[model samples]
Target: MKRAQHFIGVAVAAAAVIGVTSLVGNDYYLRIIFMMCVYYLCAAGMNVLVGFAGQKSLGQAGLFAAGAYAVALLTTKTEISPWLALIAAAAISGVCGVLIALPSLRVKGPYLAMVTLAFGIVVEKLVGEWTEVFGGAQGIYGIRPITWNDQPLTSQQWVWFAVVLCALAHLLLRNLLQGRFGRALLSLQADEIASASVGVRVYRAKVIAFVVAAVTCGIAGALVAQQNQYINSDFITFHLSIFILLLVLFGGAGSMYGPLIGAVILTAVDAALARWPSAQHFLYGFLLLFALYVMPGGVAGVFRALFKERTETEAGEKSEEPPKTTRIGPAGEGELLAVEGVTKAYGGVKPAQNVSFRLQRGHIHALIGPNGAGKSTMINMLTGVVKPTSGSIRFLGQEIAGKPAHLICSMGMGRTFQNLRLFSDLSVLDNVMLGRHTRMRNGFFSSLMGLPVAGRQEAVTRGRALELLELVGLAHLAHQPAGSLPYGLQRRAELARALATEPQLLLLDEPAAGLNPHETAELGQQLLRIGRCGVSILMVEHHMDLVMSVSDHVIVLDYGIKIAEGKPAEVQCNPRVIEAYLGVDDEDDIEARETCPPSEGRRDAET
Candidate 1:
């Protein structure tokens, strides 16, 4: 019902704008309206890159040029329809977007910005200096304009076309951004490692964002070239790129209405500055700086702050219902994970050396060691955060020694970080939903079009995530931002997120870190419950009580080497285990009197 209302509101607004344009019938006003729509198209796509995916690009102008020139050449030199030429131009520019995104895989921040900037400069030079194909400064002429019923559109008609196109773009983009696809992009922006650990393909998501930006910018360029019936090197410039960026940043890069808000206001500001070209760039510079330092979230952000969404707080809640633990993974045949001589080394430093272990399904195994014992390093290797120096790791009888983190996660291994790596800005429910990303069946087109299947799948995933939160005793806080929760709650939220992956083998790194005794006890029980539900657990913890109480089996490591492994009680009483925690005295240190008491040594180990 709310969705229907949203579309109806948009339709009514669009109709009013078109009605107003027809009534005014002024050439200058029509031109501004047309350009506003065109710039909105450009800014809409750029927002996916710079806002949602957190990849800053400055070469969008090159993509714009690709579309503009493709349309010009196709219409003036060939017999293809002008509309078909527009489609082709968008495809070409999308390919260019892929090429631009390749650098993002290796470089980021200013380095990526420079790479894209260089691409724009190269395209600008080619169009300006290459006379034969591009027409040099003379530019391409006689470009065919779009027509309806075999007649060229009038100025008012053109404005209407642009308005319709912008509306469709906004609607389609909103559909894509409000679902799993949108969540994946936002996840990328938050933390790539955490995103991948939840099964989001980092590079693929980046490329898709770039392509969205490129396609829209390209179409906007094509629209301009076709409408004017001419194109030139001057149309594609660094200033144009900067202006396009300003449209997103000044309007609110990530907000749904940011592009429209930016396009209307900034285009008007540009028109106001048109009389004095000398001062235009200077003022634009000032606005960009101001937006960066002051209005960082843009106009949309300010509006959001003024009309903040009401939320339910947990302040007055005395207690939550008892957790209903859910069934986790399928029954396992035998070994869930086997590590054979897995070693990770950095120059002279070896965090894991010739370590081997096998985790059985439906059991809780704890890896405990003092500080610097490589327990976390082993977890990292298993989850593909770090590549092993040598040896094999088999999960579900499949070799996964060097798989990508996301692929490793998809292959039935889920993990949490030693330090919290929650997508803090997202709601706790959304963070957990990201873990279900790999299991989702809907693809890009289905999500983009807001198909019924996509909605159903999203609803189902949300339900499952909420269930996972309940299992971890956090359903009451599902709607709250993950970062806003208290530290102990955040730990539970992260656990819920990892479990949403439905892993056969769950690897937890210091899951009880920073938790008080009561919280730690609850976490131990949660692990036991999860293990009973048929999921194997590999836990790295410094909390001795939690480990000894809940763990069925125990492994001990010291100075990058596995020293012992057995049943918890048997291993706890082992002489080597005691010695590793409390060093023995030699003849040279015989002045140390009697050996330290066993209770004191155990306390020292726990600390």
Candidate 2:
């Protein structure tokens, strides 16, 4: 494959550089190369956290210190092998990463950054003031360096080792980032709520990202300390954290090669500014601002903009195929969901109060209500987006009230948002593929190592996603950005994504709100088809025509209370429903109801 060949070429080039540098490059140049590798290792993991997972951390210097100090103490205070000490250092840093991730679970944005900043400051103080163990500002010395064949490496050999490590890091990260794990991180960055609805464990993903960043940065710090045979608080500063961030921002954040580019460019610039410390700080600040405001995508983004990457299209596939009619869910003949005494109140403002409902397996039920009614609130509660104040919601005969959203999704429930929460920047196929997150069986390590199982799983998920796109009439736009599609197409794309979850129950919120008559008709057909595929649907829609056409049963709510429930015709003739919609006087209501037929009432309510 072209991707395999590209990786091979990169490896060959790296090996050649290593061999050439060992023979001809001086110690100074080798040292520069060594620093670049270290920074690259740091930035590669940070990219996952900052660029993909969208967690902005400013305490990476603390994690670096954890590794550097760990190696320093393990080598100096004990008789442990330097290599084992390096592993220990990484473990320590990983633990610290988990601790740092705790704050992220509870906070976000600047608050999270401030928490990380405080962590870095605390680590700095501990290293500088804990004189007996850390050597205070004077630092630890005489730490054992890593060895090869029981011999300490030469300066050139150190660079060679770093380069090999960098190469391996690149390959491993590429394997991890291009698969389900990578997509999960990206989905987290796009929208955590949507990500959770699609079965991504949002908090768990955040912790994993932080641990990754911590481990790699820890490894880099250990390498630096071992190579130098010394380490101090000076190695772990706020400025160093900023510099590590700059490496990602300046080179490119999300791209795999961005960290390498950033490490190379920023390391060289740092070396160039070694003579003027104040100017270096000022310049770094300016560059950070510039990178943030002027070139948000960095050098790699500039290249993408200039060259415009080739479109990802399936060759020789010009016409779209009809959607597959395969069974979408397990065939069943019992109640799928039951909501009893569900109530949600916000201190005197109750969106839903003592509501009860039942949805049969493979049936399409419609929840119709005007604006300010409790339709959306019911959907939110059912999907675990909002916990009920008091209720029992049972799905598949198990109580599910107040559970996490991701857990609810994993239990074979999928949903689309009323306001549209697609991962807009991702390709339509990817957005749909994300719906299969809970179904993929490969673990983090398998994906990280690019195991055959991971590849097969990804391929299968991709195929299924494409099929879903075809079903929704968006196959031609599968490779296009989801956000670029028209509103109606986006709605269909969302439907495709939800279907990719292969849910036993599908909850759609206002699926026809913005569609034209034809599109709504198509949607109605799709719903009917989905129902025939054995997937139960609970749709909250205002378009009465679509509801009447596709839904087997209808429930009406007005002012947070259920006003009527029955077949379309029966509900249409309910006096309570008529009074709720028309607000006619008693005499007028009686006279109008006597004259107006049920179909006319339905038409008038729609008007």
Candidate 3:
């Protein structure tokens, strides 16, 4: 049904384009329309980099210049066909994009802006100074127009060609962005840390965005090469780059039609004010300022706000219950993780020291301690968020202490953060979908091309994401942003997202940190349910009541050292647990191994 609606919208837009072509015969009007299509082609891809990927590239004119030169030099020097030139231009610019991305993608935000801006200035100055072949500031000329049937294409014909190019580019880009590839980019923009935790390659996504932006601008530059039959440094300036960027931002950065609508309005306005150059400049700047200041969300954003989807109130229906899981026992031989004297030091201070423990398959093992304790550090070392020093950490019979976080995640372990790290801007469902990144086999190319495997995987993940949401009792709000949910629901959403990774062991850090008594009770139920899904759990928490209720085994840490490990009752009875929580007067007091009554430590640990 959704695909059908998408096709219907496409048909409607196609009809509108054909209508404009058939009725408008004025040569000047056709030129404006052609320019609009040119801008549309470039702006569409800009939305991906700037809007969805949330990386700034302020020097797209360099990419445009690369393509433009590819076309101009190829056509004028050799006798290459103009259409062939266009394809070559796109390829050349793609390489240029990769070159820029190598260094630029290493940094982000204003640093990226400086890199790209430098790239643009360098390209412009190079084109102007290399007078021997480029004709310097004058640029290349005598370029052949894109011809139809061996004759130069008419204004009407060129406009139609541009329209076709714009339509095709828009369709492909829109398809990619609306799929998993786009979702991952959106995930990156929202929170890089959260995105990485879900297995997103942060730098790779940024590079892909830059490459796509370059390819589109390159294609647009090819069209310009043909239209004017002359190239100049002045034409491909930083101002034009800003103009193209404004087209995306002025319309709606991430939306499909934003570029098209922005291109049409701005191109037409520029052509209309052609008689007065000074006024044209003033009005153009004013419009950009107006779009940025008055309508910050852009034209498409404003339109979306006006016609936002009505909140769906229909409750989510329950599906068949998940089958119960087997909880491993301390006596069981199926051990999932073993840490032997694992320790992590930061310069002078050691947060985790000589810690050792083993978790059996499908067991709920809890790590407990007070604020300054080393529980958090131990979990990080286990999950590869931090590497250990002078110790061994093994998961599934393999050493994994120094592996990358995503590699550990792919190895069937999932975890949540101490303070909750949800991608607040993404929809509730998207958060879970991103968690399945390691499960996906498609890379940027396969997904960008919208291959069958990518599509199949996407559909499968979407269904599974909804199912996970349903499990968390949030399927009804799948379309809503994850951050907008209530505090308790947000935590539950994080659980669903983590579970989406299909891990053998789940690590939860402070899951019950801020919940009320009633909410805490609900949390206990949720943990029990999750345990029944055939997954083991490793938790670092301070909520003693909640921990004692659910944890089958407990490990206590204090000042980076393991104090005790046993069943919940045994750890609760240990005097060291009390000393760690309430404090000990001297280092010897903790080392002396004093014994105390069971009830005293249990109450203080709970407090």
Task: Give the count of colliding residue pairs in each prediction.
Answer: 0, 0, 1
lDDT of each prediction vs. the true structure?
0.89, 0.89, 0.82
Q: Root-mean-square deviation of each candidate, in angstroms? A: 2.4, 2.1, 3.4
TM-score of every prediction relative to native? 0.96, 0.97, 0.91
Candidate 1 vs candidate 3: the lDDT winner is: 1
Instruction: List candidate 1 segments past 4 Å from native.
Output: 315-319, 587-604
Model 3 misplaced stretches (Cα beyond 4 Å)? 275-281, 312-333, 442-446, 584-607
For candidate 3, what is the lDDT?
0.82
Residue pairs in collision within model 2: none
lDDT (10s digit) by residue, model 2, range 1-607: 4558868977997899798886855788889889999999999989989988989999999999999999999999999999999999999999999999999889998999999999999999999999998998899999999999999989999998898888988888888888898999999989999999999999999999999999999999999999999998888789999998998998888988889889999899989989999999998899888989999999888987899867765422434456667578999788899989988999999989888888898789999877888999999999999999998999999999999999999999999999999999899989999999999999999998888999899999999888777777778888898887888888988998998888999999999878899888989988888888879999998887787777789898887788789887777777777777667776766556744555743753551
Location of the lowest summed lDDT over 10 successive residues in candidate 3: 323-332
Candidate 3, TM-score vs. the true structure? 0.91
